[model samples]
Target: MPATSTNTCRNNAVTKVLELEGLTKSYGAVQALRGVSLHANEGEVLAICGDNGAGKSTLIKVISGAHAQTSGTLRLNGREVRWSSPHDALVHGVATIYQDLALAPQLSVWQNVFVGAEIRKTLFPGFSILDKKRMRAGAAEYLARLNQNIDDVERPVADFSGGQRQAIAIARALLWNASIVIMDEPTAALGVKETAKVLALIRHLKDTGVTVLLISHNMDDVVQVADRVVILKAGRVAAQGALEGISPATLAQTVMTGEWPQVQ
Candidate 1:
Protein backbone atom coordinates (compact mmCIF):
# COMPACT_ATOMS: atom_id res chain seq x y z
CA MET A 1 0.00 0.00 0.00
CA PRO A 2 1.20 3.51 -0.71
CA ALA A 3 1.59 6.13 2.00
CA THR A 4 -1.09 8.77 2.45
CA SER A 5 -0.71 12.56 2.33
CA THR A 6 -2.97 15.47 3.15
CA ASN A 7 -5.10 17.29 0.55
CA THR A 8 -3.74 20.82 0.59
CA CYS A 9 -4.52 22.22 -2.82
CA ARG A 10 -6.83 25.23 -3.17
CA ASN A 11 -8.94 26.41 -6.07
CA ASN A 12 -7.96 30.02 -5.57
CA ALA A 13 -10.89 32.22 -6.68
CA VAL A 14 -11.89 30.07 -9.61
CA THR A 15 -15.22 28.29 -9.65
CA LYS A 16 -15.50 24.59 -8.97
CA VAL A 17 -17.07 23.14 -12.07
CA LEU A 18 -17.34 19.63 -10.68
CA GLU A 19 -17.29 18.52 -7.05
CA LEU A 20 -17.46 14.98 -5.69
CA GLU A 21 -18.01 14.77 -1.96
CA GLY A 22 -17.63 11.52 0.01
CA LEU A 23 -18.28 9.57 -3.15
CA THR A 24 -18.34 5.81 -2.83
CA LYS A 25 -19.18 2.74 -4.91
CA SER A 26 -19.53 -0.87 -3.81
CA TYR A 27 -20.18 -4.32 -5.21
CA GLY A 28 -21.70 -7.21 -3.29
CA ALA A 29 -18.44 -7.83 -1.47
CA VAL A 30 -16.01 -5.18 -2.69
CA GLN A 31 -15.92 -1.47 -2.13
CA ALA A 32 -14.32 0.18 -5.17
CA LEU A 33 -14.40 3.71 -3.88
CA ARG A 34 -14.13 4.75 -0.24
CA GLY A 35 -15.37 8.24 0.37
CA VAL A 36 -13.40 9.78 -2.53
CA SER A 37 -13.65 13.52 -2.68
CA LEU A 38 -12.16 15.83 -5.32
CA HIS A 39 -12.85 18.94 -7.31
CA ALA A 40 -11.99 20.30 -10.77
CA ASN A 41 -11.95 24.02 -11.16
CA GLU A 42 -13.24 25.79 -14.27
CA GLY A 43 -10.95 26.00 -17.32
CA GLU A 44 -8.21 23.94 -15.73
CA VAL A 45 -6.59 20.60 -16.48
CA LEU A 46 -6.82 18.33 -13.41
CA ALA A 47 -4.86 15.12 -13.75
CA ILE A 48 -5.86 11.88 -12.02
CA CYS A 49 -3.04 9.43 -11.33
CA GLY A 50 -2.91 6.08 -9.57
CA ASP A 51 -1.56 2.58 -9.91
CA ASN A 52 -3.66 -0.36 -11.11
CA GLY A 53 -6.66 -1.14 -8.84
CA ALA A 54 -6.44 2.31 -7.30
CA GLY A 55 -10.03 3.05 -8.33
CA LYS A 56 -9.23 5.47 -11.20
CA SER A 57 -11.56 3.67 -13.60
CA THR A 58 -14.39 3.52 -11.08
CA LEU A 59 -14.03 7.21 -10.32
CA ILE A 60 -14.16 8.04 -14.02
CA LYS A 61 -17.14 5.73 -14.49
CA VAL A 62 -19.11 7.52 -11.81
CA ILE A 63 -18.20 10.94 -13.11
CA SER A 64 -18.90 9.94 -16.73
CA GLY A 65 -22.28 8.40 -15.77
CA ALA A 66 -21.38 4.88 -16.91
CA HIS A 67 -22.22 3.75 -13.35
CA ALA A 68 -23.93 5.35 -10.42
CA GLN A 69 -22.19 5.71 -7.10
CA THR A 70 -23.50 3.76 -4.12
CA SER A 71 -23.52 6.91 -2.03
CA GLY A 72 -22.30 10.43 -2.66
CA THR A 73 -23.26 13.86 -3.92
CA LEU A 74 -22.18 15.32 -7.28
CA ARG A 75 -22.38 19.01 -7.80
CA LEU A 76 -21.95 20.63 -11.23
CA ASN A 77 -21.49 24.37 -11.08
CA GLY A 78 -22.51 24.40 -7.43
CA ARG A 79 -25.88 22.67 -8.08
CA GLU A 80 -26.52 19.04 -7.26
CA VAL A 81 -26.82 16.91 -10.41
CA ARG A 82 -27.32 13.21 -11.03
CA TRP A 83 -26.76 11.40 -14.31
CA SER A 84 -29.03 8.60 -15.43
CA SER A 85 -26.71 7.66 -18.28
CA PRO A 86 -23.61 8.73 -20.18
CA HIS A 87 -25.70 10.65 -22.66
CA ASP A 88 -27.50 12.29 -19.79
CA ALA A 89 -24.19 13.52 -18.45
CA LEU A 90 -23.11 14.62 -21.93
CA VAL A 91 -26.22 16.65 -22.57
CA HIS A 92 -25.63 18.33 -19.24
CA GLY A 93 -22.23 19.61 -20.50
CA VAL A 94 -19.92 16.78 -19.42
CA ALA A 95 -18.23 14.57 -22.02
CA THR A 96 -15.72 11.78 -21.64
CA ILE A 97 -13.21 10.79 -24.33
CA TYR A 98 -12.04 7.31 -23.56
CA GLN A 99 -8.66 5.79 -24.42
CA ASP A 100 -10.06 4.05 -27.48
CA LEU A 101 -11.46 7.36 -28.73
CA ALA A 102 -14.87 5.60 -29.24
CA LEU A 103 -14.84 6.44 -32.94
CA ALA A 104 -16.32 4.38 -35.75
CA PRO A 105 -13.52 3.28 -38.03
CA GLN A 106 -15.76 3.12 -41.09
CA LEU A 107 -17.46 6.43 -40.40
CA SER A 108 -16.29 9.65 -41.97
CA VAL A 109 -14.80 12.49 -39.98
CA TRP A 110 -17.99 14.57 -39.83
CA GLN A 111 -20.14 11.52 -39.27
CA ASN A 112 -17.99 10.35 -36.36
CA VAL A 113 -18.05 13.81 -34.85
CA PHE A 114 -21.83 13.88 -35.07
CA VAL A 115 -22.43 10.23 -34.29
CA GLY A 116 -25.08 10.17 -31.53
CA ALA A 117 -26.32 13.72 -31.89
CA GLU A 118 -26.63 14.11 -35.63
CA ILE A 119 -27.95 17.29 -37.11
CA ARG A 120 -31.12 17.11 -39.23
CA LYS A 121 -33.20 19.40 -41.40
CA THR A 122 -36.95 19.06 -41.76
CA LEU A 123 -37.95 18.81 -45.40
CA PHE A 124 -41.67 18.40 -44.66
CA PRO A 125 -44.08 18.49 -41.74
CA GLY A 126 -43.33 14.91 -40.73
CA PHE A 127 -40.03 14.14 -42.43
CA SER A 128 -36.45 15.23 -41.77
CA ILE A 129 -33.15 14.52 -43.51
CA LEU A 130 -29.61 14.47 -42.24
CA ASP A 131 -28.08 17.91 -42.56
CA LYS A 132 -24.72 16.89 -43.96
CA LYS A 133 -23.76 20.35 -45.12
CA ARG A 134 -24.25 22.05 -41.77
CA MET A 135 -22.75 19.14 -39.86
CA ARG A 136 -19.69 19.01 -42.11
CA ALA A 137 -19.14 22.71 -41.73
CA GLY A 138 -19.56 22.52 -37.96
CA ALA A 139 -17.19 19.59 -37.73
CA ALA A 140 -14.60 21.48 -39.69
CA GLU A 141 -14.95 24.38 -37.28
CA TYR A 142 -14.49 22.15 -34.28
CA LEU A 143 -11.42 20.52 -35.79
CA ALA A 144 -10.07 23.94 -36.52
CA ARG A 145 -10.52 24.81 -32.86
CA LEU A 146 -8.00 22.09 -32.10
CA ASN A 147 -5.56 23.41 -34.69
CA GLN A 148 -6.12 20.41 -36.93
CA ASN A 149 -6.53 20.67 -40.69
CA ILE A 150 -8.27 17.68 -42.12
CA ASP A 151 -8.90 18.68 -45.75
CA ASP A 152 -11.53 16.03 -46.26
CA VAL A 153 -14.33 15.84 -43.71
CA GLU A 154 -15.55 12.78 -45.62
CA ARG A 155 -12.37 10.82 -44.91
CA PRO A 156 -12.69 7.65 -42.87
CA VAL A 157 -11.56 7.81 -39.24
CA ALA A 158 -9.41 4.69 -39.63
CA ASP A 159 -7.26 6.54 -42.13
CA PHE A 160 -6.17 9.14 -39.59
CA SER A 161 -3.39 8.86 -37.02
CA GLY A 162 -3.90 8.20 -33.32
CA GLY A 163 -3.65 11.86 -32.43
CA GLN A 164 -6.07 12.79 -35.21
CA ARG A 165 -8.56 10.29 -33.87
CA GLN A 166 -8.29 12.03 -30.50
CA ALA A 167 -9.02 15.33 -32.22
CA ILE A 168 -12.16 13.86 -33.75
CA ALA A 169 -13.36 12.66 -30.35
CA ILE A 170 -12.63 16.05 -28.86
CA ALA A 171 -14.49 17.75 -31.72
CA ARG A 172 -17.58 15.79 -30.76
CA ALA A 173 -17.28 17.17 -27.26
CA LEU A 174 -16.97 20.65 -28.71
CA LEU A 175 -20.10 20.05 -30.79
CA TRP A 176 -21.98 19.33 -27.60
CA ASN A 177 -20.58 22.51 -26.04
CA ALA A 178 -19.29 20.53 -23.10
CA SER A 179 -18.27 22.66 -20.14
CA ILE A 180 -16.13 19.82 -18.79
CA VAL A 181 -14.20 17.21 -20.79
CA ILE A 182 -12.83 14.07 -19.20
CA MET A 183 -9.97 12.45 -21.12
CA ASP A 184 -8.91 8.91 -20.15
CA GLU A 185 -5.39 7.92 -21.05
CA PRO A 186 -5.34 10.41 -23.87
CA THR A 187 -1.77 9.54 -24.75
CA ALA A 188 -1.47 5.89 -23.93
CA ALA A 189 0.21 4.59 -27.09
CA LEU A 190 1.69 6.95 -29.60
CA GLY A 191 4.96 8.20 -31.00
CA VAL A 192 6.70 11.26 -29.68
CA LYS A 193 5.01 13.37 -32.36
CA GLU A 194 1.51 12.05 -31.68
CA THR A 195 1.88 12.51 -27.94
CA ALA A 196 2.94 16.09 -28.45
CA LYS A 197 -0.10 16.68 -30.65
CA VAL A 198 -2.40 15.30 -27.99
CA LEU A 199 -0.79 17.50 -25.36
CA ALA A 200 -1.37 20.53 -27.58
CA LEU A 201 -5.05 19.59 -27.91
CA ILE A 202 -5.42 19.52 -24.11
CA ARG A 203 -3.83 22.93 -23.85
CA HIS A 204 -6.20 24.19 -26.52
CA LEU A 205 -9.19 22.95 -24.52
CA LYS A 206 -7.99 24.80 -21.42
CA ASP A 207 -7.41 27.93 -23.49
CA THR A 208 -11.03 27.76 -24.64
CA GLY A 209 -12.24 27.71 -21.04
CA VAL A 210 -13.05 24.00 -20.98
CA THR A 211 -12.34 22.05 -17.81
CA VAL A 212 -10.46 18.82 -18.53
CA LEU A 213 -10.25 15.81 -16.18
CA LEU A 214 -7.24 13.93 -17.51
CA ILE A 215 -6.64 10.35 -16.34
CA SER A 216 -3.23 9.13 -17.36
CA HIS A 217 -0.48 6.78 -16.17
CA ASN A 218 2.32 8.62 -17.97
CA MET A 219 3.89 10.85 -15.37
CA ASP A 220 5.65 13.02 -17.96
CA ASP A 221 2.43 13.61 -19.85
CA VAL A 222 0.61 14.47 -16.63
CA VAL A 223 3.38 16.78 -15.50
CA GLN A 224 3.31 18.62 -18.81
CA VAL A 225 -0.43 19.36 -18.99
CA ALA A 226 -1.89 19.04 -15.52
CA ASP A 227 -2.52 22.10 -13.40
CA ARG A 228 -3.05 19.90 -10.36
CA VAL A 229 -2.94 16.18 -9.65
CA VAL A 230 -4.79 13.72 -7.42
CA ILE A 231 -3.13 10.42 -6.55
CA LEU A 232 -5.36 7.55 -5.49
CA LYS A 233 -4.36 4.47 -3.55
CA ALA A 234 -6.59 1.44 -2.97
CA GLY A 235 -9.90 3.24 -3.54
CA ARG A 236 -9.00 6.30 -1.54
CA VAL A 237 -7.41 9.68 -2.17
CA ALA A 238 -3.90 9.10 -0.97
CA ALA A 239 -2.68 12.58 -1.79
CA GLN A 240 -3.45 15.64 -3.88
CA GLY A 241 -1.74 18.98 -4.46
CA ALA A 242 -0.73 21.47 -7.09
CA LEU A 243 1.94 20.29 -9.53
CA GLU A 244 3.66 23.66 -9.66
CA GLY A 245 7.13 22.62 -8.55
CA ILE A 246 6.89 18.90 -9.20
CA SER A 247 9.12 17.34 -11.86
CA PRO A 248 8.23 14.24 -13.81
CA ALA A 249 10.67 12.18 -11.74
CA THR A 250 9.25 13.63 -8.53
CA LEU A 251 5.67 13.03 -9.63
CA ALA A 252 6.45 9.43 -10.56
CA GLN A 253 8.12 8.92 -7.21
CA THR A 254 5.10 10.34 -5.42
CA VAL A 255 2.78 8.04 -7.33
CA MET A 256 4.80 4.97 -6.37
CA THR A 257 5.38 5.84 -2.70
CA GLY A 258 2.39 8.22 -2.16
CA GLU A 259 4.67 10.81 -0.63
CA TRP A 260 5.36 14.40 -1.75
CA PRO A 261 7.68 15.84 0.82
CA GLN A 262 9.72 18.19 -1.41
CA VAL A 263 7.11 18.79 -4.12
CA GLN A 264 4.69 20.26 -1.62
Candidate 2:
Protein backbone atom coordinates (compact mmCIF):
# COMPACT_ATOMS: atom_id res chain seq x y z
CA MET A 1 0.00 0.00 0.00
CA PRO A 2 1.11 3.56 -0.68
CA ALA A 3 1.93 5.83 2.21
CA THR A 4 -0.43 8.54 3.47
CA SER A 5 0.46 12.23 3.94
CA THR A 6 3.14 12.46 6.61
CA ASN A 7 6.46 14.16 7.32
CA THR A 8 9.47 12.24 6.16
CA CYS A 9 13.09 11.68 7.41
CA ARG A 10 11.63 8.84 9.44
CA ASN A 11 13.20 6.40 6.98
CA ASN A 12 15.96 6.77 4.45
CA ALA A 13 13.51 5.96 1.68
CA VAL A 14 11.11 8.76 2.61
CA THR A 15 13.07 11.97 3.05
CA LYS A 16 10.84 15.00 2.74
CA VAL A 17 11.81 17.67 0.22
CA LEU A 18 9.38 20.40 1.23
CA GLU A 19 7.18 21.38 4.20
CA LEU A 20 4.79 24.15 5.19
CA GLU A 21 3.33 25.14 8.53
CA GLY A 22 0.59 27.64 9.24
CA LEU A 23 1.10 29.17 5.80
CA THR A 24 -1.06 32.23 5.29
CA LYS A 25 -1.42 34.98 2.72
CA SER A 26 -3.62 38.04 2.28
CA TYR A 27 -4.22 41.00 0.01
CA GLY A 28 -5.30 43.37 2.73
CA ALA A 29 -8.96 42.34 3.59
CA VAL A 30 -8.74 39.51 1.12
CA GLN A 31 -7.38 36.41 2.75
CA ALA A 32 -6.06 34.47 -0.18
CA LEU A 33 -4.90 31.58 1.95
CA ARG A 34 -5.38 30.40 5.50
CA GLY A 35 -3.08 28.34 7.65
CA VAL A 36 -2.37 25.90 4.85
CA SER A 37 0.09 23.23 5.94
CA LEU A 38 1.49 20.39 3.87
CA HIS A 39 4.58 18.31 3.14
CA ALA A 40 5.96 16.45 0.15
CA ASN A 41 8.49 13.63 0.18
CA GLU A 42 11.37 13.48 -2.25
CA GLY A 43 10.40 12.17 -5.68
CA GLU A 44 6.73 12.22 -4.68
CA VAL A 45 4.13 13.52 -7.12
CA LEU A 46 1.75 15.44 -4.86
CA ALA A 47 -1.34 16.81 -6.55
CA ILE A 48 -2.85 20.04 -5.26
CA CYS A 49 -6.49 20.46 -6.29
CA GLY A 50 -9.13 23.05 -5.59
CA ASP A 51 -11.91 24.78 -7.43
CA ASN A 52 -11.70 28.38 -8.61
CA GLY A 53 -10.80 30.74 -5.72
CA ALA A 54 -9.73 27.87 -3.53
CA GLY A 55 -6.31 29.57 -3.10
CA LYS A 56 -4.43 27.14 -5.30
CA SER A 57 -2.87 29.90 -7.37
CA THR A 58 -2.10 32.02 -4.38
CA LEU A 59 -0.55 29.13 -2.53
CA ILE A 60 1.61 28.33 -5.53
CA LYS A 61 2.73 31.94 -5.80
CA VAL A 62 3.84 31.88 -2.20
CA ILE A 63 5.64 28.59 -2.63
CA SER A 64 7.31 29.70 -5.82
CA GLY A 65 8.42 32.99 -4.25
CA ALA A 66 6.28 35.23 -6.47
CA HIS A 67 4.68 36.53 -3.26
CA ALA A 68 5.51 36.39 0.39
CA GLN A 69 3.13 34.90 2.89
CA THR A 70 1.47 37.01 5.55
CA SER A 71 2.61 34.55 8.19
CA GLY A 72 3.80 31.00 8.83
CA THR A 73 6.79 29.12 7.56
CA LEU A 74 8.27 27.15 4.67
CA ARG A 75 10.94 24.50 4.94
CA LEU A 76 13.07 22.80 2.35
CA ASN A 77 14.74 19.55 3.32
CA GLY A 78 13.79 20.36 6.91
CA ARG A 79 15.49 23.77 6.86
CA GLU A 80 13.28 26.84 7.26
CA VAL A 81 13.41 29.15 4.25
CA ARG A 82 12.02 32.46 3.02
CA TRP A 83 12.16 33.41 -0.64
CA SER A 84 12.77 36.99 -1.75
CA SER A 85 11.83 36.40 -5.39
CA PRO A 86 11.09 33.76 -7.99
CA HIS A 87 14.75 33.70 -8.97
CA ASP A 88 15.64 33.24 -5.32
CA ALA A 89 13.32 30.26 -5.19
CA LEU A 90 14.86 28.86 -8.36
CA VAL A 91 18.35 29.27 -6.98
CA HIS A 92 17.21 27.33 -3.95
CA GLY A 93 16.05 24.42 -6.13
CA VAL A 94 12.36 25.27 -6.57
CA ALA A 95 11.27 26.00 -10.14
CA THR A 96 7.75 26.91 -11.24
CA ILE A 97 6.40 26.10 -14.71
CA TYR A 98 3.22 28.10 -15.07
CA GLN A 99 0.28 27.37 -17.39
CA ASP A 100 1.97 29.40 -20.11
CA LEU A 101 5.17 27.33 -19.70
CA ALA A 102 7.03 30.69 -19.85
CA LEU A 103 8.78 29.96 -23.13
CA ALA A 104 9.92 32.61 -25.57
CA PRO A 105 7.92 31.87 -28.70
CA GLN A 106 10.34 33.66 -30.97
CA LEU A 107 13.48 32.17 -29.42
CA SER A 108 15.09 28.88 -30.32
CA VAL A 109 14.75 25.87 -28.00
CA TRP A 110 18.27 26.27 -26.58
CA GLN A 111 17.74 29.98 -26.11
CA ASN A 112 14.55 29.35 -24.18
CA VAL A 113 16.15 26.68 -22.05
CA PHE A 114 19.06 28.87 -21.03
CA VAL A 115 17.23 32.16 -20.91
CA GLY A 116 18.28 33.46 -17.52
CA ALA A 117 21.38 31.40 -16.77
CA GLU A 118 23.27 31.45 -20.03
CA ILE A 119 26.64 29.82 -20.48
CA ARG A 120 29.42 32.26 -21.42
CA LYS A 121 32.51 31.68 -23.52
CA THR A 122 35.41 33.88 -22.52
CA LEU A 123 37.48 35.04 -25.49
CA PHE A 124 39.60 37.35 -23.33
CA PRO A 125 39.79 38.57 -19.74
CA GLY A 126 36.63 40.23 -18.28
CA PHE A 127 34.59 39.55 -21.40
CA SER A 128 32.47 36.64 -22.60
CA ILE A 129 29.97 35.77 -25.32
CA LEU A 130 26.99 33.38 -25.34
CA ASP A 131 28.24 29.81 -25.54
CA LYS A 132 25.60 28.69 -28.01
CA LYS A 133 27.23 25.34 -28.74
CA ARG A 134 27.42 24.22 -25.11
CA MET A 135 23.88 25.40 -24.32
CA ARG A 136 22.45 23.73 -27.41
CA ALA A 137 24.07 20.43 -26.53
CA GLY A 138 22.96 20.70 -22.91
CA ALA A 139 19.39 21.52 -23.92
CA ALA A 140 19.26 18.50 -26.18
CA GLU A 141 20.73 16.35 -23.44
CA TYR A 142 18.09 17.47 -20.95
CA LEU A 143 15.23 16.81 -23.36
CA ALA A 144 16.71 13.44 -24.18
CA ARG A 145 16.75 12.67 -20.48
CA LEU A 146 12.99 13.32 -20.54
CA ASN A 147 12.72 10.90 -23.49
CA GLN A 148 11.75 13.75 -25.85
CA ASN A 149 13.42 14.00 -29.23
CA ILE A 150 13.71 17.32 -31.04
CA ASP A 151 15.57 17.27 -34.34
CA ASP A 152 16.87 20.79 -33.92
CA VAL A 153 17.50 22.77 -30.75
CA GLU A 154 17.80 25.89 -32.90
CA ARG A 155 14.13 25.75 -33.95
CA PRO A 156 11.94 28.53 -32.58
CA VAL A 157 9.55 27.59 -29.78
CA ALA A 158 6.64 28.94 -31.86
CA ASP A 159 7.10 26.05 -34.27
CA PHE A 160 6.80 23.31 -31.62
CA SER A 161 3.66 21.68 -30.26
CA GLY A 162 2.29 22.63 -26.84
CA GLY A 163 3.62 19.45 -25.26
CA GLN A 164 7.06 20.01 -26.72
CA ARG A 165 7.04 23.51 -25.30
CA GLN A 166 6.42 22.02 -21.90
CA ALA A 167 9.45 19.79 -22.38
CA ILE A 168 11.57 22.83 -23.12
CA ALA A 169 10.38 24.57 -19.97
CA ILE A 170 11.12 21.49 -17.92
CA ALA A 171 14.57 21.35 -19.46
CA ARG A 172 15.07 24.91 -18.24
CA ALA A 173 14.22 23.75 -14.73
CA LEU A 174 16.69 20.93 -15.20
CA LEU A 175 19.30 23.52 -16.08
CA TRP A 176 18.80 24.92 -12.60
CA ASN A 177 19.11 21.48 -11.02
CA ALA A 178 15.79 22.10 -9.37
CA SER A 179 14.83 19.80 -6.55
CA ILE A 180 11.15 20.78 -6.47
CA VAL A 181 9.11 21.62 -9.57
CA ILE A 182 5.72 23.31 -9.37
CA MET A 183 3.63 22.69 -12.46
CA ASP A 184 0.41 24.63 -13.01
CA GLU A 185 -2.13 22.86 -15.22
CA PRO A 186 0.60 21.10 -17.20
CA THR A 187 -1.76 19.18 -19.44
CA ALA A 188 -4.41 21.84 -19.83
CA ALA A 189 -6.00 22.06 -23.29
CA LEU A 190 -3.71 19.40 -24.68
CA GLY A 191 -4.68 16.59 -27.04
CA VAL A 192 -4.70 13.11 -25.52
CA LYS A 193 -1.33 12.19 -26.98
CA GLU A 194 0.20 15.50 -26.00
CA THR A 195 -1.23 15.19 -22.52
CA ALA A 196 0.32 11.77 -22.24
CA LYS A 197 3.64 13.21 -23.31
CA VAL A 198 3.47 15.87 -20.60
CA LEU A 199 2.45 13.32 -18.01
CA ALA A 200 5.37 11.14 -19.03
CA LEU A 201 7.71 14.06 -18.52
CA ILE A 202 6.26 14.56 -15.04
CA ARG A 203 6.76 10.90 -14.24
CA HIS A 204 10.35 11.15 -15.37
CA LEU A 205 10.89 14.03 -12.96
CA LYS A 206 9.51 11.95 -10.10
CA ASP A 207 11.61 8.95 -11.04
CA THR A 208 14.70 11.11 -10.86
CA GLY A 209 13.98 12.18 -7.23
CA VAL A 210 12.42 15.55 -8.05
CA THR A 211 9.47 16.48 -5.88
CA VAL A 212 6.53 17.80 -7.88
CA LEU A 213 3.67 20.02 -6.76
CA LEU A 214 1.10 19.45 -9.50
CA ILE A 215 -1.84 21.86 -9.63
CA SER A 216 -4.40 20.29 -11.88
CA HIS A 217 -8.19 20.06 -12.18
CA ASN A 218 -8.17 16.89 -14.23
CA MET A 219 -8.78 14.18 -11.64
CA ASP A 220 -7.94 11.45 -14.11
CA ASP A 221 -4.47 12.87 -14.55
CA VAL A 222 -4.13 13.27 -10.81
CA VAL A 223 -5.19 9.72 -10.09
CA GLN A 224 -2.85 8.38 -12.72
CA VAL A 225 0.20 10.21 -11.40
CA ALA A 226 -0.26 11.58 -7.89
CA ASP A 227 0.70 9.47 -4.91
CA ARG A 228 -1.19 11.79 -2.56
CA VAL A 229 -3.49 14.78 -2.97
CA VAL A 230 -4.46 17.87 -1.06
CA ILE A 231 -7.83 19.47 -1.75
CA LEU A 232 -8.33 23.07 -0.72
CA LYS A 233 -11.52 25.05 -0.28
CA ALA A 234 -12.05 28.65 0.79
CA GLY A 235 -8.35 29.21 1.44
CA ARG A 236 -7.90 26.14 3.61
CA VAL A 237 -7.16 22.49 3.21
CA ALA A 238 -10.48 20.67 2.96
CA ALA A 239 -9.32 17.10 2.48
CA GLN A 240 -6.12 15.17 1.84
CA GLY A 241 -5.04 11.54 1.51
CA ALA A 242 -3.38 8.92 -0.62
CA LEU A 243 -4.89 8.05 -3.99
CA GLU A 244 -4.38 4.34 -3.44
CA GLY A 245 -7.90 3.12 -4.04
CA ILE A 246 -9.89 6.21 -5.01
CA SER A 247 -11.26 6.71 -8.49
CA PRO A 248 -10.91 9.93 -10.46
CA ALA A 249 -14.65 10.63 -10.30
CA THR A 250 -14.55 10.35 -6.53
CA LEU A 251 -11.58 12.66 -6.40
CA ALA A 252 -13.40 15.17 -8.62
CA GLN A 253 -16.46 15.06 -6.41
CA THR A 254 -14.26 15.50 -3.36
CA VAL A 255 -12.72 18.59 -4.91
CA MET A 256 -16.17 20.10 -5.65
CA THR A 257 -17.90 19.15 -2.42
CA GLY A 258 -14.88 19.47 -0.08
CA GLU A 259 -15.45 16.02 1.34
CA TRP A 260 -13.57 12.80 0.87
CA PRO A 261 -15.57 9.78 -0.20
CA GLN A 262 -16.67 7.70 2.74
CA VAL A 263 -15.42 4.17 2.94
CA GLN A 264 -18.06 1.45 2.62
TM-score of each: 0.93, 0.94
The top-ranked prediction according to lDDT is: 2
lDDT of each: 0.88, 0.90
Give the residue spans of candidate 2 off by over 4 A: 1-12
> How many steric overlaps are in each model, in order?
0, 0
**Model 2, 112-203: lDDT tens per residue?**
98888888999999999999999898888888888889979999999999999999999888888888999999999799999999999888
Candidate 1 Cα misplacement greater than 4 A, ranges = 1-13
| Model 2 residue 116 distance off true place after TM-score fit, in angstroms | 1.4
Give the C-alpha miss distance for residue 2 in model 1, angstroms: 42
By TM-score, how accurate is candidate 1? 0.93
- Model 1 clash pairs are none
